[model samples]
Target: MASATFPLLPSAGRRAGLILARRTEPHACRLSPRFSTTPRPPSVPPDVAGRRAFDLRDERGEDNSRAQSMGTLLSHAGLMPHRDGNEPLSPPIELATTYERPPDGNYLLEDGRGGGRVYSRTNNNTREALERAVAEMEVWNPTRRRPKRRVGEDRLSDGSTTPPMADSDTALPPPPALPVCASFSSGMAATSAVLLSLNAPVRVVLPDDIYHGIPTALHSVFRRHGVKWTAVDMTDTDGVKEALSLSVAEVEGTDGDVVLWLETPSNPLCKVTDIRALCELADQVRCGGGSDVDGGGGGSCGVNITTVVDSTWAPPPITQPLLLGADAVLHSATKYLGGHSDVLMGMVSASSATSSGRRLGAALREVQSAAGAVPSPFDAWLVLRGLRTLDVRIRRQCSNASALAEFLSSHPGAGRVHYPGLRSHPGREIAEGQMSGGLYGGMLSFEV
Candidate 1:
């Protein structure tokens, strides 16, 4: 009997935008016509103790030398191995529902033999590629490779060029652990995974203008499991702080935990929340900084406070929540990430700042594997293909959205225009300071 192994990506170093596949020794399965003629790595790295499912390498060595621009990262994040030389330009879809299992009862073989990968629901090469692609986007530091803006692109009131909101000097550093993103069947499934992964008796502080699905889920399904939530104006940092303080006091002396749920450039309303400010507040509550009289009164000193941002409406290059200190960032890949409206997927990427935050990725992975709420391999491939054009698509979307918002605002029939890019927007100042390149986002709503 021959033993086989599947190596996805490396665990350490610059692991973004790399994919590898190998078959150890020869077996009857090797002759199957179902297998494509994908080139193999010249050699697979020795298996380390803590190696993970995905270990794609950026053979070009560009990922390790310098940070690439958002456009470049998106273009190559989910890069497949080359054809004959070793790496691929595009990903090959692996639609096998099940892989060969070992004759022995043990399925825990470190190598690919036996039941190492018994089911496709839990482990799929195509899906994991999508996860790695999105994870790269989430963790990429735009400050590392700031693109030079064109003339008259974003001038200030004083006729000076408006500096980028997130610059190299001011941007937050990368987290200790490499960011790990988990892909789910749908956006709601991704949201549910985050809530379920948390310790029970949880209280989620939700934004008043968030997508309706969140509140509906909390009230319908999650409430039965002791999951409670409260809605507040997230734009008002003070109001958000008050909500957290009260939530902690209410759950004091119990195993109750808190999650500050944020949806920036909120759905329908398009109101922007100060993600950095709220994340800092969550940290203060988690680390006991909010124990003073003005704070949460010591009850929140050691309480677990997780900050999650639902940036579905404002995807990357425009807003990177993890870099702004969020514990985890969620994306409804069904939208921008899958641009052509042909796929349904969701992603939740964990930040590596704190111990718990670092473990969050693995925790989400557990929930994903157990719950089996994962997207099909084909859907994952579609999203991966869509990622390559995300930067260009988003730029044009933002430009068109801004123009439409202006036209609506000027129309006498329109009552109110809701867009963070407009000066009339109340959160325009915070949005200007938080959003990169002065490009607000593609979503806007107006009252007629």
Candidate 2:
């Protein structure tokens, strides 16, 4: 299938721009819902401003009845019914660059309520539909399923009050809130937004085996602007801790920040980093304590640090870094989420539970809107179409890659095959715990 083929590009060029340069003018298109066979109710009322409505509940309001399989969820992510009761199962693509304004020339009313439509650069119907679907898929919490609860017992056992239950007859726990997702013109655009959003001087720690373009950008673009970076072997937890300690010490007196940028199952080498361990280390750093560099007692540094995971190679159904306590998760939609080599887009998913996370999310959105690095309506629609079949495509790719890895490992001419599924691989134990659905991933590298 076209979606299974991963294209190769020049390493020296800007990857995001190169992928986008291949895009031609989009043609007028509308996809029918023949792909989604499951039947659903006619219309779900839209949520109020700043509220999320992606939770899938049934007529009985049971939690287990929600879509438990990846295939089922992917088939139904962005489709919504119209008020006329004959809406299309597929989401519509609106090509208008701008929206009509109200007669009073005010976008917001006295109550701060307004219509959904706005300028395309800030928000659009198609882009929002895609965002909703991606957010739902990325942040699905399986632990929310619980044993049945009796009536009138929804309140906390400790006497703390709780929000009213959706159903008075049954005391059901509230569904998990969705994470925030911001789409950009390209993967690098999203990456740059996150790095540029840091208001203070930062020391970015990176894996020595990560994608070369990132380090290249850090040196060529961000380095001149006062941001510093260091490369270390992320597999060595001790080395990583030492690097963080030195990083904080190097900029101890200034209002400098530290960031751990991780790419697990790293490019080419396929070295896996322990995300949980790194997150714990970041937490310790944020609490104003620094690890002793020369095996001495720890001291306070008053520095802040956060962990960001680039999980493009291990998209949904394979790994979820956020659940393991990563502050943010980024992806190159052009590679996996799009499934096919069509759309040039990127996405960042992060929780709003912490003040730092919320501020970073806002900064990313501000950069996206003010800099006009938003995806086009047609490109967003193409990505949405690709997402409907991501699960099936990725599964087949994984199977093929695993079989090839086994074959290459036994070959005398094939020097070494780097794949986490292989028992001989150093990161196999960590991969066994982090990956899901009995698959390592579709990507693998070998020395011929």
Candidate 3:
């Protein structure tokens, strides 16, 4: 009844990079090995919870504090210790991105049964494995120490990292799983997928000042497709409600299935909405501002509508919409997820309520396959590679942005600078509520 163990993997956390080593033993890997030597903390602190051990760091030469947040064992130090027969998947390379079946007479596209992978897209080992993990562990019941979120990386004093997928601790629970996870060629493709699944001619409620793409796509593309749109001043619920009413009263039917686009610390402006409150309104499909409305509308009034937020702005770790009650979530992976603007990809992380969430996933995948918009395995690989450094990147970006903002604010040349980290920011209060934990984020804009 002994557990399989792994080895110590480490790197300097300058950027996210992983190191993998193979172990051939007398048992020919009869049992899983243990990799991590981090002694379990004698007693984890209440206010302080972070990953601390230096076998590896993402891209940063320092240790990754977030990666350590999940009780993640970076080293495959202990593996399949409780397996019955044996670890079924060997080569872990076969576990790479696909599998193959015997090329028998039974192999036909129409009647393909027991056939191996028809295509990598239909069945990618790495992506599927990741999807499986997402489906199983999408719930957000994070604790001080035993957090549900983990990437299991082993860091060292050098600049190499080991991913948590290398450890069993990375396999998440299943309640978060659904049948679909739609990936897109770019941010536009992902948002387009949302438009396609929703059946156009409907108005999309957006923050008056948000990402330029929404309007660009809405006008050039979506409008051509019969999709109408409106903008909301998301200062408070009531203001959003006024915008919703203006949009709704102009349209027909039982409010219809409208889409609410959320972009907190909105692009350029850095304006934010209390997602928790907004999501509550969205769930009820109501709109109106509460007394919190800045100047548009006062009193306790709010609105609700089908809610979708571009997590790309703040990213997930900084702010999580699914936990707040987002019907569907989208990410322009190109921005932060890709870390480098080089690769272009978008993702729709959906909840179970929206079938388009599922449908969009399938449809997007189909489009990607048909149009060859499918992210190259290499590109996808690179993106996954970048993800390991996300926390470090974001934190660094925040530091850089904050420093820049401070420099501008104190400058007489600067007219008005809007950054949540700055005390003068109107949305700072709301931003503080969600983006706690000593992280102000990396992208802050200034106005000259």
Candidate 4:
């Protein structure tokens, strides 16, 4: 967050190989004595030295000050200059399909995390930069340290507890890791990656009014995947509970996976689901307690149930689903994150706490790198630029949408305006509690 203004260099009759000495302070630069054979100082500024240099304090005297707001984080995107000092202010687009190997010739480091770039299909600097920006924007507060918890305590935001491990020798669970994000070529591609990544014999529960692309992909792209899904009225908590209960019974003794897919303010209908209540329900199902259709079973069925939220309609600026006890949050970056309809991209941010959530995140990354459905470097850069204006753009769009919904509700020709901000909207209270900045969002639908 320290903003510095450097003096511009003169462009008259400069040699190609000549290097300029950098100044320590603003307006304090000095030129080195010229020599024919001696090497010139580096054109870029040297790292400022001293005890204060090692401290990570920002201009505001706070550490990691950029995490304070979405606007601040996005504004500082790709601003960290390279240590070599030869990089440009703007993040240069790395279009190379492959990177040069270091002299050691090891593509992957020993720890498995420190590999130099191998191929663009797996990872690239530009894409990684965009991923970091998106992850920062989606988190509630990146700088706030999580409170330490005792072993055997539930890690979920909800009070529900995970079943204890059967083995007495089992070690205490590791601390939940921060969320991981992966970018994809298209929204459906991201969806397919998540679906296909799941182990076979899985049960998926989805809202009846979600985006049409999901159903389309299920039938066409992921038809061969061995997962069965049911469409339910997610607005009806009791109905959803019943569906989950029955699905669990059907998959009992088979060791199948159960997933609850949620989409609040569902596409085209704008019907909101109670995320907290549903998360509790999913937890109950995962722990094996639902209305006993098979006659009052006391214990859980050991099914691995996870909830995923498609928050594309309500991006990070509008709502954050991960904090609401969801295992993962998905977004169609092509929609609002880009703010303009020019780029096609998708993102998934998954929790690192639960074994299933961590597995899903890793599998999605594997599918992304192996299947080659990644966004282009230029496309990722465009989305990053769009994110810089997201905070302001969403506020204006929400205001306009609220006003328009009110106008449409009063019009005699218009039938039933479907917007959460409207007074007559069924989910008005839920939206007010869940959405950020007291705004319901820009998307609304109405019948004429």
Candidate 5:
């Protein structure tokens, strides 16, 4: 479990590089369907442009009935642009800090994938690809496996990655909209973007025991900017409801934002917050259904409540907060997503499930560029590499953590072992309900 320290030259371009240090732990750590156990079709020769040498199909020329696993998604993420045999298998690092404008003077990008990249600080292909990969994986459902790609199926056929509309009445409800993602220089930057993106006069509800950095940011930095926050026991549904109610009541008539910041399988303590329950409560307050908090009057349209979950401890295929009704989800890619301790990056994915979520996503994109806290193209590319193996690494980590937790719980010297997988753990049931495949996570803690 050695740690690596590397100079991270951000988009800001500093002569003295900012060092990003990461501990590449076994606990913290994908492949394509083409290499699956299922039989594969014979490979075809590459075309002139060197693309689509072979189709991803079985011997019968039938698409695999299995839904594309998370592992495959991670391994193949950010590889769309390279699907052609002509391009490099790995994502290319676009080193240019700026792109030339078209001769016609129009800055719009026709690809729609890389929106008008006039400057690297605001936009870069490397960073945007990672954002799209994260957003797409965040919404993927493992339980309801869709058959592998139909012959002519394209995720962006509708000009977006939304799942195509179902043809029959028996079709499942349309999945939640794919979230919008923004990458940052660090986890704190991502958190700050969400807090800073809010209109002034904001109230942020935080878990009493959570990531120290977030509370630090709010108290020391954001507080001076008219942002208010209260720490509540997130597991206590009533207490959380009260805190949101009171915070909203204080800003009853004003135009502002209330953010419920959650960290699940929370840092050190392994506290699992009921994301869906709290999100429902926040919605009730946002819609002014909490009559006691605001004199039973209609909810203030001026006051907005947003639920953001910092799932740094729980990466995808482990837990998806946005799918659980969160307005957004944040991850410190430097930790688990990067997996190799070589990249320093953060991600903020705003859910498109709600109108408020949509607005938050738009605002966050603006803050990312305006604040200029963008990660370097190299750092972003590193994360893309890390993502390729995330599925296998984390599953193994979770398996290891489960064993460690069991041993600790029975040890004579150990006082307490905290892990969601354990039956004795307070949040075990909730974790089982939310976490995919009953995989609690890699984080565990104990005191002797």
Candidate 6:
């Protein structure tokens, strides 16, 4: 369909199709056997790569089947999308009403032996396909820090003999497979889901200059649920220590749920946090004596803190936070994943944070279903539709921003330029340590 002319190819199948049409009176033609192109309902036609495929259908086939074809495509076409993949240039799939589930089919609203879907609200093919893809792609491996060399269990403090620190696991964990992905209505929806899941005090160690949404999300959502949050500045290592120490003392007997959220390349200002260092601090905070609770090394005394890093600023091939020891990676897929600034969405990826991030996924699923935060297939498709360009967009944004930053840095009216792409950025070293792609970013904010 991408090609306007389905001119019967030299292939025997095309020839046969045409021959059959000609042999039988156009009005008397019968339908052919059903054939599905992909295993998952989302798999699009081989020609459904680039453009929207709803309008385009095989001109040779019985047009009556277009409805079912549309359903299958709406649910699965967005899965393995190809940038250069051909498309028939069709209208999008928009099923106004729910369809009955086949005997073997699973329906979103259907609750049965397999929890089949019975209604569009309960579940839809599009949502299922998207959820599966998003879930699979969200899986990531969280990094763990190595323990500092210790002489013995007891330190020089009080001159007491210390025991040798134990090695938990020198090697890091492999990334986990993401099975479920949550698409939130707003940033608050995403944050609120994580905070309220735990029915206890929740500490949010945040940077001083944090995004307003984060604070509002934590306060309105968590506070209302009776959870507490504590903020932390990444600038001073000792500040992190002090905050954690005091926080621990406060949570004495009541196991408070402490979640430390970080925004690297600090929003609006391109400030970067050393994920490696943050993870280390989180470990030290979680482990009583700076030991490894995440298993990188034990006996050093560090608690296992649920360190969540917002990776929306940089997605895969650019930066992967779980690789740097972050317990979980959260994304405001809106900026980058959503690309055009058209769609608003958020995502949470798991690493070592909460049981391979599965529990978090499960909890999010509940919250999403309960709160109705899951994005529609169209929205998910739209968001993912932009993801294919994430790499290019970030690269170009980084280059362009760097150029602008340099201009601003030298401009007479400008006081300063804080762009991280510039080698002068203090956190550039840390940025280079964890970021997977371009040296710069697609966004930069400054004043005259």
lDDT of each: 0.77, 0.74, 0.58, 0.74, 0.80, 0.58
Give the per-residue lDDT digits (tens) of candidate 2, residues 28-86: 22223432447776653333211122123334454533325766778765686343333
Per-residue accuracy of model 3 over 1-448 as CA lDDT, tens digit each: 3333444334542122222324444223322223334566577442222334333353355423333331132112112333532343321222344444446644355555453565666555545433332332233334422323344553533445545633234433433445355666788888887766653346788888888978998998778767788777877688776666666555544423467788876887787678777765554434332322221111123322456778777775577666565666777878877787788887776665443244445554565555544455555554555565666677778888889888999999887887888888887888888875555667777767
TM-score of 4: 0.74
Off by over 4 Å in 2: 1-67, 81-87, 109-111, 114-117, 146-172, 251-254, 288-302
lDDT of 3 at 57: 50
Query: For residues 1-448, what per-residue lDDT tens digits would candidate 5 score against the true structure?
Result: 6865544455543433343445575232112233245877775443411222223334456534455689988988676564532356687898899788887666877754446769899878888889999998899885554534333433332243323334433334545678999999999999889988888789989999898888888889988898888999999988998999889888776777788889998988999998888877887776755522322111244468888899999998899988887878999999999999887889999887666678889999899989999999899999999999999999999999999999999999999999999999999899988998879999899997
Give TM per candidate. Answer: 0.74, 0.76, 0.63, 0.74, 0.79, 0.65
Q: Against the true structure, whose TM-score is highest?
A: 5
| Evaluation by TM-score, superior candidate among 3 and 6 | 6
> lDDT tens string, model 1, 39-106?
76575333321121112222332232245688988887566643422357787899999877667756
Candidate 4: the clashing residue pairs are: 288-300
- lDDT for model 3: 0.58
Model 5: how far is 281 from its true place, Å?
1.0
Residue-pair clashes per candidate, as listed?
Answer: 15, 0, 74, 1, 4, 42
Which stretches in model 5 have alpha-carbon errors above 4 Å? 1-65, 82-87, 109-115, 143-175, 290-302
Ten contiguous residues with the weakest lDDT in model 2? 47-56
Candidate 6, overall lDDT?
A: 0.58
Query: Which residue pairs in candidate 5 collide?
Result: 30-389, 50-85, 51-85, 288-299
State residue 269's C-alpha deviation in candidate 5, in Å. 0.8
